[model samples]
Target chain A: MITFKNVTKEYPPKTHALAGVSFRIEAGEFVSITGQSGSGKSTVAKMIFAEEMPTSGHIHIGDWDISNIRHSDIPVLRRQIGVVFQDFKLLPKKTAFENVAFALEVAGESTKRIREVVPHVLKIVGLGEKGGRYPRQLSGGEQQRVSIARALVHRPKIIVADEPTGNLDAITAREIIELFTRINDFGTTVVLVTHDRDIVNGLHRRVITLRDGKVSSDAEKGKYLLS
Target chain B: MRSFFRIIRFALQSMMRNFWLSFVTVSVFVLTLVTVNAVIVLNVLANASVKSVEGRVQVTVYFTSDASESTVKNVQSYLLGLSQVKDVSYVTADEALAQFKENHQNDPVILASLDEVDGNPLGQALKIRAYNAGDFPFVLQALETPEYKPFIKDKNYNNYESALRVLSDFSEKVRLGFLILALFFGFIATLIVFNTIRVAIYVHRDEIGIMKLVGANDWFVRGPFLFESICYAFIATVVMGVLLSAFLTFANPAIVAFFQGVDVDLVSYYLTNALPMFGAQFGILALLGLGTTTFAMRRYLRV
Candidate 1:
C-alpha cells in the first residue's frame, strides 16, 4: 500500500510540480495515474521510489516514511518498489537476461536465486526465449518487456511503470498493459503512470487524474478525458 | 563473496566491451611510465658521467726545490686528514721526473731535456683527490693554511676548475630538465586518463541511472570503473616493464661502447631494483586512475 497525504513537490522559483496531491493505493489493486505532461504523474512515481522527496506533507510506502528517507536507505527502498521507465532503461551492453539479472544482482541476491528468478520473470513478460538478445537487438516492444522483466525480478510488492508503453505501437502498448493486468491479478499492486487515452479507457480500473498540479477526479472505473 | 565475484565479472565485461577506451587508457599509462623511466635512466647516466669526470680530476700540489722530503710528507698527511680530500698520494721529486721521462719517451727532445736537467729538477708533489667535484674548491682552499702554504710552489687547483664547473653544471641542468619533462608528461597522462574515464562514464550514464533505479549500491555502481582502472594500470605496468627490458638489452652494448671507460651498467641497475621500482610505478598509476574515475562518476551517481 502507498499513501500520499497532502503531498506537495515544488521546484524552486515558485514552480509547483505537485500541490497537495492526496491519494491512497490499497494492496492488490491496479491503479492508473493519468495526467498531461507536467501534471506530476511521473513525479508521483519517482516519489514512490524515493527518487524525489516532497517539499511538504507525507508520502509513505507501506510503513516506511519515505518523505525523508536517508541516503543509505534509498537503495533499500528502491529494491522493494519495482520501477519501469518510459525509455526502457535497459543497459545496451548487457543481454536481455543480464538486464533482468542485474536487478536481482543489485539486491545481492544469491547466484542461484538470480539464475532462477530472471528466467521466470522473463517468461512472465513473454521474453523467455530471447534472453540472449541485447537491447539493440530487440524491437521496441521487446525492449519494454525486458524492462518489465527487470522490474519483476525482485518480486516487488508494488510495480510502478511510468509510461512504459510510450515508445511502443498500439498493439504493443496493449500487450504491455495486458502484462501489467496479468501481474496485478497475481495480487501485486500496480501503479501505471500514463496519459494514453485509449489505454486508460480500456483499463476500466481505478484511475486518479491530475490537472493543474492537483487531483481533479478519482473514480473506481475512470475514463480518459483531457481537460 | 558472490557480489565480489560479480563486481569483478562486471569489470572485466565492461573493459572488454569498451576495448578501444581501455586500450587508449592503458597506452597513456604506459607512456607516462616511459617518461618516468626515461628520467630515471637520464639521472643514472648523469650521475655516472659526473663521477667519471670527478675521478679524472686530481690537483697536484708541487713543492719548491728547497722543501725537504719530510715537509712534503707532512703536507700529504695534512691533506689526507681533511674530510673533503678522499685520497692523498705523495710523489717524490725523483718519482715525478721518472714519470715525466716515461710519458715523453716517444719525444726524444723532451726526454733528453729532462735527462740533461741537474739532479731531478721536478718538485715533490701531493696529488689531492676530493670526494665530489663541487668539493674540489674547498679542498684547494684548505691549502691556504699557513702550515703548508710556504713550501707549496704551485697548486694545480685552478687547472681543473673550469672542467669541474662545466661537468657539475651540465649534469645538474640535465637532471633538472629530465625532471621537468617527466612532470609534464605525467600531467598530460593524468588529463588523458581523466578525460577518457569521463567519456566512458558519459557513455554509460543511462545504464548508471538504470542501475541506481534497480537498487545498486554506490560501490556496485562504481566497482566496474574502479576495477577497470586497476586493470589498465596492471597492463600498462607490464607493458612498460617489457619495453624497458628490451630497450636496455639492445641498447646496452651501444651505450657501453659510447661511454668507453665510464662505468654505466644500466642492465644491472634495473635488474637489481626492478621489483620495487616497477611496483611503485604500478601503484601510482592505479591510484591516479582510480581517483580520476571516481571524480568522473560523481555527477552520474547523483541518481
Candidate 2:
C-alpha cells in the first residue's frame, strides 16, 4: 500500500512540482497515474521511491514514513519498492542476467540464491533465453523486459514504473503493459505512470490524472480524460 | 567477505572492459615513479662523489728541519687524540726530501733548486685527516699553541677548505634542482590521475546510476572504483621494480668503471635498500591514487 497525504514539493523561486497532492492505493492494486508533461505525476512516482522528498505533509509506504527518511535508509526503502525508468537504465556492459542479479548482489544475497532466482525472474519477463545478451544487443522491448526483470528480482512489494514504455513501439509497449498486468496478478502492487492515452484507455483500470500540479480526476475505471 | 571479493571481481572486470584507459593510467603512474627513482639515484651518486672528494683532502703540517723527531712525534700523537681527527701520519725530513724530488722530477728548474738547497732541507710533516672536512680549521687552530707554534713551518688547509665549500654548494644546488623536477613530475601525475578517474566515471555514469537505483549502498557503488585505482598502483609499482632491476643490471658495471676510484656501487646500494625504498614508493603512490579517486568520485560520481 502507498499513501501521500497533502504532500507538496516545490522548486526554487516558487515552481511547484506538486501542490498539496493526496492519494492512496490499497494492497494488490494496479494503478495508472496519467498527466501532461508537467502535471507532477513523475514527481509523485519519485516520492514513492524517496528519490524526492516532500516540502510539506508526509508520505507513507505501508508503516514507513519516508518524508524524513535518513540518508542511510534510502537504499533499504528502494530495495522494498522497485523502480523502472523510461530509459530502462540497464548497465550497458552487463548481460541481461547479470543486470538482474545485480539487484540481489547489492542486497548481499548468496551466489547460489542469485543463480537460482535471476534466471527465474528473467524467465518471468520472457528473457530466459536472452540472459546472456548485453543491453546494446537487445531490442527496445527486450531491454524494458530486462529492466522489469531486475525490478522483480527482489520480489519487491511494490513496483513504481515511470514512463517505462515511452520509448517502445505500440506493440512492444502493449506487451510491456501486459507483463505488468501478469506481475500484478501474482499479488505485486503495480503503479504505472504514463501520458500515453491508448495504453490508459485500454487498461480500463483505476486512473488518477494530474493537472496543474493537482489531481484532476480519480476513478476506478477511468479513461484518458486530457487532450 | 563475499562482498569484498565481489568488489574486487567487479574492479577487474571494469579494468578489462576499459583496457586502454587502464593502460594509460598505469603508464602514467610508472612514469611518475621513474622520475622519483631517478632523484634517488642522483642523490646516492652525489653523496658518494662528495665523500670520495672529502677523503682525499687532508691538512699537512710542516715542521722546521731542526725540529726534533721527538717533538714531531709528540705533535702527531696530540692531533690523533682529537675525536675529529681520523688519522695522522708523521713523515721524516729525509722521506719528505725524497718525495719533493720525486714530485719535481719532470721540472728541471724545481729539481735543480731542490738540489742546491742544504742536504735534505725539507721538514718533517704530519698529514692530518679528519672525520669531516669542516673540522680541518679546528685541527689547524689547535697547532697554534705556543709550545708547538715556534717549530711549525706552514699549514695548508685554507686552500682545500675553499675547494670543499665550492663542491658542497654545487652538490646542494644539484639536489635542489632534482627535488623541483621530482615535484613537478608528481604534480603532473596527480592531474593525469584525477582526469583519468573523472573520464572513467563519465564513461560509466549510466552504470553507476543504474546500480544506485537498483538499491546499491554507497560502498557497494564506490568499492569497485576505489579498488581499480589501487590495482593501478600495484601494477605500476611491480612494473617499475622489474624495470629498475633490469636497468641496474645493465648500468652498474659502466658506472663503476666511470667513477673508477670513487667507490660508487649503485647496485649494492639499491640491493641493500630495495625493500624499504620500493615499499615506501608503493605506499606513497597508493595513497595518491586513492586520494585522487575519492576526489574524482565525489565530483562526478553522484552515487
Candidate 3:
C-alpha cells in the first residue's frame, strides 16, 4: 500500500512540480497515473521510491513514513520497492543474466541462490534464452524485459514503473503492459506512470489523472481523459 | 570475506574491460618511480665520490733533522691518542732518506742532490688521517705544543682544507638539485594519477547510478575503484623493479670504470637495499594512489 497526503514539491524561482496532491492505493492494486507533459507524473513515481523527498508534507508506504528518509535507509527502501525507468538502466557491459543477478548480488545473496533465482526471473520476463546477451545486443523490447526481470529478482512488494514503455513501438509497449498485468496478478502492486492515451484507455483499470500539480480525476475504471 | 573477494573480482574485470586505460595508468606510475630511483642513484654516487675524496686528504708533519728519534716517537704516540685521528704512520730518518732517493731516481738533478747530501739528512715524518676532514685542523692544532713545535718543520693541512670545502659545497648542491627534481616529478605524477581516476569514474558514471538504483551500498560501489588503484600501484612497482635491475646490470661496470678506483659500486648498494627500497616505493605509491582515488571518488562518484 502507498499513501501521500498534501504533498507539495517546489523548485527555486516559483516552479511547482507538485502542489498539495493526496492519493492512496490499497494492496495488490494495479493503478495507472495518467497525465500530459509537465503533469508531475514522474515526480510522483520518484517520490514513491524515495529518490526525491517531498519539499512539504508526508509520504507513507505500509505504515513507514518516508517524508524525511535517512541517507543510509534509502537503499533498504529501494530494495523493497522495485523501480523501472524508461531508459531501462541496465549496465551496458553486463549480460542480461548478470544484470538480473546484480540486484540479488547487492543484497548479498548466495551464488547458488543467484544461479537459481536469476534464471527463473528471466524466464518470467521472457528472457530465459537471452540471458547471456548484453544490453546492446538486445532489442528495445528485450531490454525493457530485462529491466523488469531485474526489478522482480527481489520479489519486491511494489513495482513503480515510470514510463517504462516510452521507448518501444506500440506492439512492444502493449506487451510490456501485459507483462505488468501478469506481475500484478501475482499480488505485486503496480503503479504504471504514463502519458500514452491508447495504453491507458485499453487497460480500463483504476486511473488517477493529474492536472496542474493536482489530481484532476480518480475513477474505478477510468479511460484517458486528456486531449 | 566473500564480498571482499567479489569486490576484487569486479575490480579485475573492470580493469581488463578498460585495458588501455589501465595500461596508461600503470605506465604513468612506472615513469614516476623511474624518476625517483634516478635521484636515489645520483645520491649514492655523490656520497661515494665525497667519501673517496675525504679518504685521500691527510696531514703530513715533517720534523727537523736534529730531532731525536725518541722525541719523534713521543709525538706520534700523542697524536695517536686523539679520538679524531683515524691512523698515524711514522717514517724514521733512514726510511725517509731511502723513500726520497726512490722518488728522485727518475730525475738526474734530484738524484745528484740527494747523493751529495750529508748522511740521512731527511727528517722523520708522521702522516695523520682523521675520521672527518673537518677535524684535521683540530688534530694539527694539537701538535703546536712547545715540546713539539721546535722539531716540527711543516704541516700540509692548509693545502687540502680549501679544496675540501669546495668539494663539500659542490656535493651538497648536487644533492639539493636532485631533491628538487624528485619533488617536481612527484607533483606531476600526483596530478596524472588524480586525473586518471577521475576519467575512470566518469566512464563508469552510468554504471554507478545503475548500481545504486539496484540497492548497492556506498562501499559496494567504491570498493572496485579503490582496488583498481592498488592494482596500478602494484603492477607499476613490479615493472620498475625489472627495469632497475636491467639498468644496473648494464651501467654498473661503465660507472665503476669511469670513476676509476673511487669505490662506486652501485650494484652492491642496490643489492643490499633492494628489499627496503622497493618495499618503500611500493608502499608510498599505493598510498598516493589510494588517497587520490578516494578524493576522486568523493568528487565524481556520487554514491
Candidate 4:
C-alpha cells in the first residue's frame, strides 16, 4: 500500500511540482495516474521511490515512512517497488537475461535463485526465447518487456510503471498494457502513470487524474479525463 | 559463499564485456607499479652500497718513524679502548712492507720500488674499523678527544680525516639524492596512473552509468577493476624482480671486470645483499597498486 499525505515538492525559486498532493494506493490494486507532461505524474512516482524527497509532507509505503529515509536505504525501498521508465534502461552490452540477472546480482542473490527466477520472468514477458539476445538485437517493445522482467525479479508488491508504452506503437503499447493487466491479475498492485487516453479507457480500472500539480479526479472504473 | 561467487561472476562478465577499458586501467596500474618498483630497488641498492662502503672504511693512524715499538703498542691499546672503535689492528712497519710487496707483486715497477724502500720506511699504524658507516666520523672525532689526542699525530691524520669526511659526505648526498629522485618518479607515476584511469572511466562512462542505474553496489562494481589493477601490478613486479635478479646474478662478473679498479662491483655487491631491495620493491608495488586505484576511484566513481 502507498499513501501520500499532503505531499508538497517544490524546486528552488518557488516552483511547486506537487502542491499538497494526497492520495492512497491500496495493495493488489491496478490504478492509473493520468496527467499531461509536467503535470507532476512522474514527480509522484519519484516521490514514491524516494528519488526526490517531499519538501513538506509525509509519504508512506506500507508502514515505512520514506520522506526521511537516508540515501543508502533508497535501494531497499526500490526493491519493494518495481519501477519501469519511459526509456527501457537496459545495459546495452548485456544479453536480455544478463540485464534481468543484474537486478538480482546487485541484491546479492544466489546464482541458483537468479538462474531460476530470470527465465520465469522472461517467460512472463514473452521473451523467454530471446534471453540470449542483447538489447540492440531486440525490438523496442521487447526491450521494454525485458525491463519489466528485470523489475519483476524481486517479486515486488507494487509496480510503478511511468509511461510503460510511451515509445511503442499502438498495438505494442496495448500488448504492454495487457501484460500489466496480466501481472496485476497475479495479485500484484500496479500504478501506471501515463497520458495515453486510449489505454486508460481500455483498462477500465480506478484512475486518479492530476491537473496543475493537484489531483483533479479520482474515479472507479474511470475514463481518461484531461483537467 | 554462493553470493560471493555470483558477485565475482558478474564482475568477470562485466570486465570482459568492457575489455578495452579494463585493459587500459590495468596497464596504467602496471606502468605505475613498475616505476615505483624500479625507484625502490635503486634506493635500496644505493643505501646498501653506501652502508657497505661506510662499514668497510678503516681509519689508519700512522705513528712517527722515531716512535718506539712499546709506545706504538700503547697507542694502539689506547685506540682500542675507545667505545666508538669496533676493532683495532696494529700493523708493524715490517708487516706493512710485506703487505705492500704482496699487493704490487703483479706490477714489476711497483715491486722494484717497494724493494728499494730499504729498511721498512712505513711506520707502525693502527687500523680502526667502526660498527656502522655512520659511526665512522664519530670515531674519527672521538680520536681527537683529550684522552686519545696524544696518540693521534698530525703525520697522517689530516689526509685520513679529509678523506673520511669526503666519503661520508658523498654517501649522505647519494642517499638524499636517491630519495629525492625516487619521490619525483613516484609523483610522476601517480599522475600518469591517475590520468589513465580517469581516461578509461571517461571512455566507459555509459557502462558505469548503466551499472549504477541497475543498482550495483559500490564494492560490487569496483571489485573487478581493483582486482585487475592488483593483478597487473603483481605480474609487473614479478617480471621486474626476475629481470633485475637475473641481470645482477649473471652480469655481475662482467660488470666487475669492466670497473676493475672500483671498490664495489655494482652488480654482485647489490645481489649479495638484496633483502632490502626485495622489501622495497614489494612495498612500492603494493602502495602504487592500492594507492593510485583508490585515489582514481574516489575521484571518478563517487558512489
Best by lDDT: 2
User: Model 4: what is its DockQ?
Assistant: 0.37
The C-alpha stretches of model 1 lying farther than 4 A from their native spots are: A225-227, B61-98, B101-161, B299-301
Comparing 3 with 4 on TM-score, the higher-scoring candidate is 3
- Summarize candidate 3's per-residue lDDT along B5-65 as a digit string, tens digits: 7789888988887788788888878887887898788778877777787888889888998
Q: Which residue pairs in model 4 clash with each other?
A: none
Error of 4 at B14 (Å): 5.8
Query: Each model's number of backbone clashes?
Result: 0, 0, 0, 0
- Fraction of real interface contacts that model 4 preserves: 0.36
Residue-level lDDT of model 4, residues B169-278, one tens digit each, is: 77567656666666666666567656655665675576565555555566766665565455545555566666667766776677556534445465554567566765
Worst 10 residues of 4 chain B by lDDT: B154-163
For candidate 4, give the docking quality class from DockQ.
acceptable
Candidate 3 residue A155 Cα shift, in angstroms, is 1.5
Distance from true location, Cα of A217 in model 2, Å = 1.8
**Candidates ranked by lDDT:** 2, 3, 1, 4
DockQ of candidate 3 relative to the true structure: 0.67
Model 2 CA deviation exceeding 4 Å by range: B64-71, B101-123, B141-152
